[model samples]
Target: MKAFVFPGQGSQFVGMGKDLYETSPLAKELFDKADAILGFKITEIMFAGTDEQLKETKVTQPAVFLHSVISALCMGEAFEPSMVAGHSLGEFSALVASGALSFEDGLRLVAARANAMQKACEANPGTMAAIIGLSDEHVEEICKEVSVGGKVVIPANYNCPGQLVISGDVEAVDAACEKLKEAGAKRALPLKVGGAFHSPLMQPAQEELQEAIEKTGFNTPKCPVYQNVDAKPHTDPTEIKQNLIAQLTSSVRWTASVQHMIADGADDFTECGPGKALQGMIGRIDRNVALHGIA
Candidate 1:
């Protein structure tokens, strides 16, 4: 079976969709539609804007979504997947690609999500860190230990074996990194992110995004979508929506999601996005699977 995956934020670049916009009519039309939908020329920022401008949460989220979804859609008949999954913000892209959500609705939801998250960041300041060469259990234990009193810290992304990202208040995350390094982690490095995502700090964002998710219409996708919240495949719109609601405050089980996909017979994994981040993570998760990318 084939599994098509989408990447999240941090995969974007200054000239992300330039080639697509210049080469494919469908892509050009979608880019124009996105510009109108967003009420700003996102294509300009995506194609030639400065990195600082592209780094804005609002722009980065939608930019990555457009690139990923358009990359998959432009493939036409060749884009087929028995199952699909995406990382963090890429979930919206996956939904649009798999036919669960209309392109316009998906873009709207992504924009709303990005805005909400940005607000939550300003309201509750926090950060994230990458813990390398540590077991999931170790990272979780260390985070729990650091999250004392009213402080909050937790494992945010189970990207692959021996690599996990933790998110929480800046002080708590810094303390956790100190302990994780002492626990034999090869490296405990802070990420250059605007806020702590996939942690309790995002609860505010979750509430704000829930309203948008609830109001949006979701159709039954042609294939099952393995969600980030639980690493489980879901086809029901109601179930998918609920999972999406919780995704902001839940860890992205990328390692487990890939494992489940392979266990369910997905041997061919094709990534449709701007970068090969998902492919690299999947490769580290399981080296036996055939991995490739569309972008």
Candidate 2:
């Protein structure tokens, strides 16, 4: 069986989806529709915008979604997946690809999520850091015990073996990094993200997104989508909504998600996005696994 994956933020770059739009009429049509739906020329930004412009959360989320989804679109009959999973923002892309959400609705939700997260970041002013060569339990324990000024830090993304990302207030994150390094972690590096995503700092964003998600409708997907919150597959709409709502404050279980897919007979994996980050992570997680990239 084939499993298709989508990448999250930090995988985007300048001229991401330009090639497909310029070469395929189908891709062009989709790009035009995205522009109309987004109320701006997002394609221009994605195709020609500088790195600085694409780094904006609002632009970054939607641009990466468009690239992954459109790349899947251009694949036509060749795009087949027994299971699908995405990292963070890429979950929206996987939902659309699997038919759980319509293209326009998915894009709208992604935009709303990005804007809400950006606002929450501005309001909280927190950050995230990458901790390597530390057990997840040790890292989490350190973050929980190393609070400063009553601020909280927590493990955020489990990217791969020996790699975990922590998110929280800037001071708490910095303090936690020092502790992690002292705890024998190989490296404790701060990420360039604007805020402490997947942490309590995003509570406001989660609350705002709840309304948007509740108002939107979801359909049964063509295939099962391994969600980010739990890294499990669910077909029920209500359950999907609940998981999505909880995802904002939950660590992205990418490593576990890939393991589940492998155990469930994911013989081949394909990453559809701007970068090969997913492929690399999946490779590290299971070297025997076959992997491919879609644009």
Candidate of highest TM-score? 1
lDDT of all predictions: 0.95, 0.92
- How far residue 19's Cα lies from its native spot in candidate 1, in Å, is 0.8
Clash pairs (backbone) in predicted model 2: none
Candidate 1, which ten residues in sequence have the lowest lDDT sum?
140-149
Judge candidate 2 against the unseen true structure and give its global Cα lDDT, from 0 to 1. 0.92
Please list the residue runs of candidate 2 whose C-alpha ends up more than 4 Å from where it truly belongs after superposition. none
User: Where is model 2 poorest over a 10-residue stretch in terms of lDDT?
Assistant: 141-150
Tens digits of per-residue lDDT, candidate 1, 1-295, equal 9999999999999999899999999999999999999999999999999999999999999999999999999999999899999999988999999999999999999999999999999999999999999999989888888888899999999999999999999999999999999999999999999999999999999999999999999999999999999899999999999999999999999999999999999999999988999999999998999999987
Residues 124-211 of candidate 2 have per-residue lDDT tens digits of 9999999989888899899879875679998999989999999998889989999888899999999989999999999999999999
Residue 130 in candidate 1, Cα distance off native in Å: 0.3
Q: Which numbered prediction scores highest in lDDT against the true structure? A: 1
